[model samples]
Target: MDRNAKFIAALKRLQGVAPIQVWPATVKSIQGTNCTVDILNTDLIDVDEVNLRADDEATEGVLIVPRVGSLVYVGAVENAVDNLFVCQVSEVDRVEVKIGNSLVTIDKDQVKAVRDKCELTLSDKATLKQDQTTIELSSGKVKINNSATSLKSVLDDLTSLLQNFTVTCAAPGSPSAPFPATITQVTQLSTKINQLLS
Candidate 1:
């Protein structure tokens, strides 16, 4: 063939090769760990039973499951429908990273990290929460808050320690009456403080 004809034939062959399809999709429904989504493009309509991307060797099974209506990425081998797969969950308005049950989300106003039942945040101040307890770190001090019963128990323990405290004079000889009087005053002060705490 002439050079121009050979070049044209090569171009035709290249056009025949199918290209991989990747597009953003909206999650429709979830069944177990699998989900369905509607692709945003006109070529592919909808994909069903798409599994969420998770670690195969994870002992905790699937932890992070995308909610319905969230955006995600879908991929397929050329135009093969059965080979379609959910690549990753896409954060539409924020940047989020998830691994198993751990998640970190970042936005213009705040940053949050969560793992299991614990959540940590960093913004104008830093905060952490585990179950009902919260610890906030800001302005060079750490403030912890817990259940009322827990705080009361701590106070009770302090009261008991103070009530049972004994002061002994370090002198080799018997202390004078003034020393004994000072000890009595300290014990009375401890009792008053404990009563106020209670």
Candidate 2:
């Protein structure tokens, strides 16, 4: 073929393999994993059924659903107008993240988590506050309701006082001391408390 005809043939071959394109858009609606968006700053117009971004293979990673009327960045693969997908969003209505058996969900109202166990480890301290009440954990100590007393310490003091309990006998007919049954019950109570709190 002539040089000019060969050049034209090459251009035709590259026409369908163009670079990806990204456009700013406004979300119009959402259904399942797809949404329609109005492409901004150009005459490109609205695109329908564009895929939303999924963090993982669409089934096991983060999923963010943008609110309607929110701004987003939509990407088109190979510059194809019909192969568009959401790449980034400005505002989200909900977000969900799942990895293995753990899952976390966040929405406008609340955040929820599901897992076998959860643990928070801190270097110095941690506190949970609500209005005037507070629970603080620091230096291997726990303070509840802004008080210095701990449940285990209170139980220990009570057990110690009961174990050493005594009574004054002002009259000869009065009982010499507490009943033997009372002492036995106190010992059993102490044992149970230790088992529960240990």
Candidate 3:
């Protein structure tokens, strides 16, 4: 089944014995592959259930903080009026990247995946990938290919990756430099380990 349909199906399993209602939704946009679902239930529900059910491979405890976003994915039930409602919060009036960074501007549709950006931007599909890797990230898709690079190259990659952000990197006593750590280091380490194992 399509990702959205599968996500919705997974979401269905989480509805409790308590009377629950899924408000009408739309396919606002696709963030990589998985779709967003703005479920307007009577009581605000936990978002992590959707992530857990959508992909059975992962299992993590979920804690919902005010103002933080969450996801819910479900599988299919035939004759159950299954339709894809890929709606994401498309208007990100304020998006905070790192732990201590200020909010920034972005399109509302792509705001679903704007968690703490530490080199890696984790998606609802639950894939670790390079974040801010392009000017136009239509959807956050994980490309399966390991490309080797040196320290300089990695730094250059990060510089370019965060070039557009407004957060000032203040470690070097300069205003323009960005915060120093990113998921890039993890990528480099993985590449080295793979090379050794190979």
Best by TM-score: 2
Q: What range of 10 consecutive residues in model 1 has the weakest lDDT sum?
A: 55-64
* lDDT tens digits by residue: candidate 1, 1-198: 999999998877865696556778898876655678898865555578775644433444333456679888877756576666677775433555766788888766788999999999999889998887777889987666565434444556557656765556667796634456556756655654554334
Query: Model 1 Cα displacement at 189 (Å)?
Result: 20
lDDT of 3 by residue, 28-102 (tens): 233422344444443423222232122334233221211234333233233132433222333332333323332
Better of 1 and 3 by TM-score: 1
Q: What are the per-residue Cα lDDT tens digits for candidate 2 across 42-154?
A: 87666787887632245677778899999999998888787898999999998877788777777876566655554232335665543344556888888654233345555
User: Which order, best to worst by lDDT?
Assistant: 2, 1, 3
Q: After superposition, how far is residue 128 of candidate 3 from its true place, in Å?
A: 19
Model 1 misplacement above 4 A: 1-19, 41-46, 54-65, 92-155, 164-198
Candidate with top lDDT is 2
RMSD values, in order shown: 9.9, 10.1, 20.5
TM-score of 3: 0.17
What lDDT does each candidate get? 0.68, 0.73, 0.37
Off by over 4 Å in 2: 1-18, 42-46, 54-57, 117-198
lDDT of 1 at 125: 89
